[model samples]
Target: MHIVVVGLSHHTAPVEVRERLAFAPTAMEKPLHQMLALPAIAEALIVSTCNRVELYAASKEPDTAVATLRRFLADYHGVPLEEIEQNLYDYQGEEAIRHLFRVSSSLDSMIIGEPQILGQIKTAYGYAVEFRTAGLILNRFLHKAFSVAKRVRTETGIASSAVSVSFAAVELARKIFDRLDDKGVMIIGAGEMCELAARHFVSNGVTRVLVTNRTFERAEKLAAEFQGRAVPFEQFTDHLASVDIVLTSTGAPTFILGHRQMEEILRRRKNRPMFLIDIAVPRDVDPKVNNLDNVYLYDVDDLQGVVQANLKERQKEAHRAEAIVNEEIGQFHVWLANLEVKPTIVALRRRFEEITAQEVAKTFGNHKDLTDAQRKGIEAMANAIVNKLLHRPIALLKRTQNETGGEDYVDTVRELFDLPAPAVDETPLEPLDDDTDNR
Candidate 1:
């Protein structure tokens, strides 16, 4: 089976289309299992994030896999197939490998060099593993991709810069407060983004954290994980005045914190410096809060500037990372090309050994005086001659087939020798704990 990736991302589709196609974390399991159930698909993984919804699968026929995935996506999103078809991009074989490597390396992200994509990819891979959907091909490809990403992060300077929105929020807060360790951080919601922001703060040694959510249990649960205190939803505004940093990310479908409430909090603080990071999609903090004295309110768009600056710095290191990926892609292509020749090589070797065995038996029958050691020597010599004769031609054929599209040469080899079709074992592949798989 060959690797095929069919999907739309920020590069091909806008956020509106992407959101429509997005598979929520809870919703992914059923669709993933359904995709795996398709006869053509041998393995599959779905990477669904805010900006992209992609399906990476190994299938016997790429065309059939793409068609099935398109239909599945349309049905899941309740949108017409044609609508998504227009924006979808298909990458097969080597191109698919390169695409996955680039994604894991963060080069394909909206904000280049952002570290979150790696985590997202790992999460997707983990889900596929849990669902028992990923097979040997996908497991190998993804593990290699992860290794490439880790190398890029360590060997290059790409990760040194803060490029992700969450880290950018922390950077903006640092600009306002000068020190994060002494800051009091009040997280306004219990969403994933907010949780990430809180974790960033906690990692940076923030002194105090107060989490508040519409659901008190969720707030308490999240807060307790980080050794922070949870406050009642009604007390969010009151506690807002005491904190040096306020981060809000909620799904209220409306503005939860208005200008008037923020104005009162700002007044209570008595012109103390405060950093307000509003990461919510619908905008939790009022836009007018930026006008208030001693209050620095940064929204999603503001974070984009920081990410942009970080991207510019990372662009220099990206060339190095791209070179690594290209080298890896070349190596993978060589392996793939060899994969197409493996069955022919095996069959030809088997054929030669069979012929050698038959001829040896006939000769031995006539030479009854021959010793056992002599007979064994003759058999070994025959097998060695067969291997030495076939090695050069097999290597040349593989090279010619991969380079010149010489299907006729491979076909001739198969037809003349009566070789069997290539067989791919469908056993589930294990994940690598170290770099042993790479070797």
Candidate 2:
């Protein structure tokens, strides 16, 4: 048996192509069932995220399976194979296992070390379990993949830092304040980055949100979205004392917030520390405002620097994560190798036992004068001889299954002994944990 994966990702395909191949979580059962129906595929799972779409399968004929998966993708989405063939990539054996490990560990993400892809993969696995598409190999493979991801997360700093500007602002805010639930945030403008930062702050437990824009209607709209109140543009300074965090992003060419304004605001708040994020390109907050006591100001450059530094840290941690993946791949490959050899070993032993039984029966029938003791002696001697004769070959098979040309040895053994083909394994798919996200 062989494991294979065929699909396209952000590295090989643009967003338009990815979108075309994407699968909806609610509708996975049909395609999974269809793929399982194909002769070339024995087990299957589909992982569809915004950045990637992949079909992972276990098969006896790997080359045929890869072609089947690629065609399945094109046919399912009603796209011609030629249009998407260039964007597809396929891997088999250890390479396929390596790809899955890297993806589950977030090392293959467009933004390395992001955590969402892992959860998305878990959800896909959940669908496979629910639909009974993933059998023995995939059940174990996916669980192992999850454990490898967990190890990477625990042993490395890949997910320890924020890699985006908006998230960096929130990270700095988190460091300054012990808790964000009680802190109030104010947005001075309606720039996209400012809105994104505001959303990040709210998701991270900021309870209060104050939005101010040149247009009162825009402020009111944004404030309502956050479940907070809107402050008029001209009167936003008056409300600064009520907020602990401030994010400013406006198209104005000059500084809208100066040192004098922050000094008075600090006094009104009894000199409490405040986090000011100035993400506007031309600088909305005056550079001199950073000199005020108990006030922390991070302009665009400052936040960008923080993001760059954090990205580098994540990159360093990613190398460690790759090592973890490689170690796991080796272990999983051994398990797969054993899986491939198990049936052959069983069949070889059975073949020897059957031949011995037939010969022993013929001898007893022909003699017709054997005593019970004599028959027992003959049976024991026959079993011992069979075992002795088979030991070396079975030993060789087990010892060599994990090495190069292992499958060839299995084939040669089967041919020499004239053993029947190994039976297809249809073990029931095991259910994934309900809390896959936590792991």
Candidate 3:
């Protein structure tokens, strides 16, 4: 059996399509059960995130399995097939394995090397395990993928930078302050962009959120939402003396606070370092404020530019990450190929021994005068012959374990020797935890 992946991703579909296709995390148990119930799918797992949704499966007949999954995706999501057919990208065999490794390693994310994808995949796999939809191949494949991702993180600096606007703000905040717990944030507007930044700060343990808007009622509403205090718009400038961080995105066309006003405010606070993030399109704080001492100002463009630069850095680091993935893929592939090698060899030896036993019985019947010592010598000779004949093929199988067409070569030998097919064990192929299995 081979691994297969049938689904869509950020590279193949837009957000509109992805949202319609995603399997909600809270409601995935039934979907996983439905997927595993399909005859073509031997094992199944679903990974759904904001930017992508993928279905990883294992089957003996890859083509049939992929088709079956595609049908399932459409029917289950209640989406029209024609609308999503062109957005799908499927891979089988080694390519499918490589795809999963890349995804788990975060190389396939919209923001390359984002740390969230690994956790997302892990969560999905956890659900699959909980539902018992994943067994053997898929569990092994995902575990190896996690190991590869861990190696990549240790070996490369792919995720060492911030690549999103909100996260970039958080990084800058860290650089400005020794610790966030002591800092206070004053949000100047109720825009979604500023709210995200505020949330990031609050999540980082900035407990004080002083919200102010033109309308006190709106300011009070937003402040209550974050469980903080609200200040009147006229009184915000006075409270500026108490805040260390200022986040603003308002409808004002001109600068609300000039350098002169900031200088007076800084003097009252003994010139304590202040961070200003003006996310407004028309620019909230005056550009001259950047020239003031101990004041750091970052506008929307500045934050986005930093995010873009970090993205480029991530892209460069992604090349190194991909190399790591390729190396891991080779090792994992060899392990998979060798999974059936020992079993096949055991079966072949058993088959030869059975044939030899039958021949020996017939020979003894024909030559009734043969002694017991002669019978023992004949059995030992048969065993020696079988061992010598099997040595070269077994050696070749081990040597080509990581090479192309290794499984096919093993299959040809099995058929040529008329060996029985290996029994299927749905239990996870145990990981390399044992002393002997470590190889």
Could you give candidate 2's per-residue lDDT for residues 358-404 as a string of tens digits?
A: 99999999989999999999999999999999899889989898787
Runs in model 3 with CA error above 4 Å? 14-41, 46-53, 61-86, 114-120, 123-133, 153-160, 213-235, 250-253, 268-270, 424-439
lDDT (Cα, tens digit) per residue for candidate 1, span 333-366:
6655566676677777888788889999999999
Task: Give TM per candidate.
Answer: 0.62, 0.85, 0.83
Give all candidate RMSDs, comma-separated: 8.9, 3.4, 5.2
The best candidate in terms of TM-score: 2
Where in model 2 is the C-alpha error above 4 Å?
A: 20-30, 71-83, 190-192, 208-242, 250-253, 263-272, 292-294, 421-431, 434-439
Model 1 accuracy (lDDT, Cα)? 0.83
Clashing pairs in 1: none
Ranking of predictions according to TM-score: 2, 3, 1
